[model samples]
Target: MTLTIFSFISFTGQKSKFSDIIKSKMYFKTKLKKIPLSLVKQENTFFYFTDENPYYFNLLKSSIAKLGILNPIMVQPFEKKYYRVISGFRRLQIAKELGFTFIPARILRENLSPSEILTAVLLSHPHPLSLTEKVRIVRIMKDLGISTSQICTRFGSFLEIQSPHLLEKYIRLSNYTPSVLSYISTHGLSLNQALAFENLSSEEQNLLISLGTCLSLKGYDFCNILKVLKEIETKEEKNVAAILKETEILNVSKDVKLTRSQKIDKIKKILKMKRYP
Candidate 1:
C-alpha cells in the first residue's frame, strides 16, 4: 500500500463563488492507498448523474481493461474498517467488474462534515452537470441546512443559475413525484414547463405523462397541451383528468392508426375548441 499526503489549497489573489468554503480555517489531508474492494462501500451521496450511453460505457470498459485505473478513487472512512466512496463511482464499479481485488484510492484521514465532502466531490467532478444533477444538488444542500442565499451565492456558478429566484424554482422541483421529475429531465423541459404540473394531482400528472408518451410530444408541445388543459379545466369547471376522459380526446389518444404528429395535432384542435367554446 503506497501512501502519499496532499494539501488542499486555493489560488492566491483569485476570488471564487465558493470563497466561503475555500477560505475556511478547516483543512484536511488525503493520502493515496491500496484499499481492498470489499472494504470499500459502493454508495454515492452527492453525485446523481448517470451516463446512459452504452458506447461511452463500452469505451470506458475497454480503456480500463487495457490501461487499468489511471486515477485513484476518493473515499472516506465509514463504519469500522470500511471506506465509503465519494467520487469515481463508475471507475470503482468497472474495477469490481474487472475482478480487481484491490484498487488505488485517496483516503480522507479526517472526518469532515457532509457539506465539506460534497464540496470536495463537486470540485473534483470533471464533466458539466446535467439539469437533473443540478436540481439534486440544490435539494441536497438545502436539506443539509444550507440557507438558500448561501446556496445561491456559493453554487450559482457551479449550477449555472445566477438568480436566487430561479434557484428556488429548481428547488421546488423536489415536490414533484419521482416519475414526473424523470419525465422533466428526459424531455429537457424548462423550469416553467416543468412547474406547470405543480397544480396537478398525481393521477392527472400520470395521465399527462401517458398522453405525452403516446403522442411523442416535444417539450414545447407538452407545455402548450398543459396550457390548453388548464384553460379548459377552468372554463368547463372540471379537472384535467375529467377533461381528458372526454370521448374525442380519449379516442384520439387511443387511436393507433393516427401518427404521433397527427394525434397531437388532433388533440390540440379538440382542446382549443373546448378551451374557446
Candidate 2:
C-alpha cells in the first residue's frame, strides 16, 4: 500500500493541485448581472428617507452634514438615459435640498460578480457605530488598503450604541409624525437619539415629534422631556414653558440617588462645592 501511494504521489505533479480543484468547486456563488444603466430602470427615485433603512442612516446628522456627500447615490441605469437609485436615497434628497441638478452615479458596464453585488450591498447599508466602531473601521480600511467609503459600500456600517438612555425619545418622534424620521435625517438629530425616538409607541412618538416639529427645534433630545410631558396628564397640564426651563441639565453634574430630604441636602452640598471648590 505504501508503494502504491508513492506511485500515485509521483504520478501527480502536486497533490495540492487536486485538493485545490475540489475545494474550489464547493465555494459560494453569488453575482449580480450588471445590466447597463440604460437596460436597468429608475422610477419614483426621489422619496424622503425612512428609518426602515437601518443600513443607510448613521447616528449623527451633524456628521453627514459636515462630511457633505462622499459617495454618489447608486442607481441602475435603464432606458438609455434614465436610471433607478439602487441605494443612497438620503444622499439624493440632501442633494436636492442642497440644490444640485446632476448627481454622480455608476451605471452597470459588465455582468457584476458576486463580490460586486455584495460590495453594492455593503455600500448601501451601514450599521450604527460608536466611537470605537469608527476606529475599528479606520484600522480595517488601512489593513485592507481601502477607503472607509469602499468598506462601507461593501460591508454594512457597524455602529456602536452610544446613547441607550435616549431611545424612547427617538421612538416618540417617529410616533408623533410620519415625517419625523426624515426630519431627524435632515436636521442634526443623532442616530442613537433617532433610534431612541423610534423605540417609543407609535402614538406617543408621533405626539412628541409633532410638538417638536419646527425647523428651528433641531436638537430635540426626547427622553426626559417626553417623560415630563407624560408625567402631566394633558398637553394643557404640561407647562411647556416651565418644562423647558427644567429641560436644561448641567451636563457635567454628579448624579446621586437620594430621598426627597436627602436630595435637598445633596443640592446644598453641590452648591457649596460649586461656590467653594
TM-scores, one per candidate: 0.76, 0.35
Misplaced by over 4 Å in model 1 are: 1-34, 42-72, 97-104, 247-256
User: What RMSD value applies to candidate 2?
Assistant: 16.2
Cα lDDT tens digits for candidate 2, 138-188 = 343334454334333332212221233322232233233435555565455
Q: What TM-score does candidate 2 get on C-alpha atoms?
A: 0.35
Full-model lDDT for every candidate: 0.72, 0.40
lDDT of 1 by residue, 102-139 (tens): 99877754567777666656655656777666777777
Q: Could you tell me the lDDT of residue 42 within candidate 2? A: 48
- State in Å the error of residue 29, model 1: 5.3
Off by over 4 Å in 2: 1-41, 44-73, 77-82, 87-105, 109-118, 121-178, 195-201, 218-221, 233-277
